[model samples]
Target chain A: EDKVVQSPLSLVVHEGDTVTLNCSYEVTNFRSLLWYKQEKKAPTFLFMLTSSGIEKKSGRLSSILDKKELFSILNITATQTGDSAVYLCAVNLSSNTGKLIFGQGTTLQVKP
Target chain B: SAVISQKPSRDICQRGTSLTIQCQVDSQVTMMFWYRQQPGQSLTLIATANQGSEATYESGFVIDKFPISRPNLTFSTLTVSNMSPEDSSIYLCSVGQGTYEQYFGPGTRLTVT
Candidate 1:
């Protein structure tokens, strides 16, 4: 079955801690891998990785994809309490442009 | 990126009642989708609202229960019929931005009593 798996379901860290979230997928064919941060009711878009090795960075958040290995990782540097949220990884299938297969997500708790 | 908006950000409705959530996009989009997120669970695709046609539902979802309509490229609506406690979830609408990304709305938090 096509699925996206995220590692370290939950994590607790103090401010300034760096964390790496893993996402591995087993899908027939996919177009891209995406990351989002859910702080409350809405999830904010983080990064979209379509190419391998090339890391996409915004502020302290960065993500990279390994298409050959069928995995991706999201790294957060210098985390803060404001970064406490569920970080979700999703695979955008190549066959379907409107659907997203989401992982269980990693709950990151940043303590002050 | 599309700016999506959903109506009735949060609502508490009694069991068996039905609620319709509207989604509007800033520009015309080719694909509009509806998703449901249960408490403590990840998001699940409910259906894809096709413009000028019947919505396509995902596995385990039915049209009679979750009817969707896309009257135009920039707007869509999802109606949850005969709501149950299990139906209480965050209903979100997203528009396909370009070919790889989907921009989501604020979402409607539905509570069933």
Candidate 2:
């Protein structure tokens, strides 16, 4: 079975601090790793990483994948109170099945 | 990008009752997926609803318990039958264009008592 593990299940940081969330996976036929931000309801797409050493970024958030190590990291710099939410990491297997195996999300709280 | 809408934002049901959640996408998508998120947990895929085909369920999920119907490319429904307290969860629907990522709908929060 494909499995994903995320570290530091919960974190609290002051405003403007930087935080890093980690995700490691053991998936057969790996394809891509994805990051999402969930506030209350729906989760919004943040980044998708396909190759090693390649970084994908949007605003204050950036992510990178290490295919050789089967791991990924999401970094949030200059965090604001609005950045408080659960950050989810998921992996898509290469089977074209449209299935995603997700890790238990990291809950982040940014306090001003 | 597709905008998906789900009906009955939340409901509190008694045990043994059933709830049918509806999902509609603003734009046509080739694939729709259903997932469950228990409190303080990660999301688990329930099934993949394909247009004009039977929904493909994941391991530990059965079609009889969570019946799904996808008549076209933009719409689908998931019905949780014979609900128990364990069935209480947040159900979310998602749509994709066969790409690497998917857009999600506002989830339906169900609480079975």
What's the TM-score of every candidate structure? 0.97, 0.97
Docking class of 2: medium
Tens digits of per-residue lDDT for model 2, A1-112: 7899998899999999999999999989898888989999899989878889998888899999999889999999999999999999999886477688889999999999
lDDT of 2 at B22: 99
Give lDDT tens digits, candidate 1, residues B1-113. Answer: 78889998999999999999999999999889999999999999999899999998989999999999999999999999999999999999988857567778999999999
Scored against the native two-chain complex, candidate 2 gets a DockQ of 0.77
Question: Candidate 2 iRMS, in Å?
Answer: 1.1
Candidate 1 TM-score, C-alpha based: 0.97
List fnat per candidate, in order.
0.65, 0.71
Error of 2 at B60 (Å): 0.7
lDDT of 2 at B32: 91
